[model samples]
Target: MSKRLFTTQIKLLESNPNIEHVSERAISYKPEFKLHAVQAYKSGRAPMQIFLEAGFSCYR
Candidate 1:
């Protein structure tokens, strides 16, 4: 993902009341997964949509 969009998403996540917290530690271990999420979003997929897909795949 481009730095601009990634920064935007992070800011959105951080500001969302529903998100609770956007901590580095929570997401740090899955850098590759996060990258995939970002790329998916950049490629036209919705971030939340890709996130759910990736999150489920990670558990399985």
Candidate 2:
């Protein structure tokens, strides 16, 4: 099977405050976002919920 490429719309993430950097293979989120995600997870928030709240999407 072919490897799935990271082809999400980079422009949409470029303006997100939670995002520190966007590259062809990965996304770098800000430290604050990392903390927030962890806290949210501990608080029982779903992973998808945390991502959506931080302006991230799983769809391509």
Candidate 3:
């Protein structure tokens, strides 16, 4: 996705009260890895596995 769309989506999520701690640090993910992270989240998998599968070098 384009940077504009990504930022807009993040902004929309941040505005929702249900989305607590919706900061950059929490939402930040490389574009190339975002799809994997999203899939993991949808599958109710562990965060660590999600991050790793998403190709995040450092997940902690």
RMSD of 3: 11.8
Question: Top TM-score: which candidate number?
Answer: 2
Residues 1-60 of candidate 3 have per-residue lDDT tens digits of 323333435665554433443454356434545565577688898877764554433422
lDDT of 1 by residue, 1-60 (tens): 322333335554554333444543332324666577678888999866875664332221
lDDT of 2 by residue, 1-60 (tens): 446555666778777899898776777999999999999999999999999988777656
Ranking by lDDT: 2, 3, 1
**lDDT of each structure?**
0.51, 0.82, 0.52
Assess candidate 1 and give its TM-score to the true structure: 0.41
- TM for every model, in the order presented, reads 0.41, 0.80, 0.34
The model with the greatest lDDT is 2
Off by over 4 Å in 2: none
Error of 3 at 46 (Å): 1.2
Supply the TM-score for candidate 2. 0.80
Clash counts for the predictions, in order: 0, 0, 0
Worst 10 residues of 1 by lDDT: 1-10
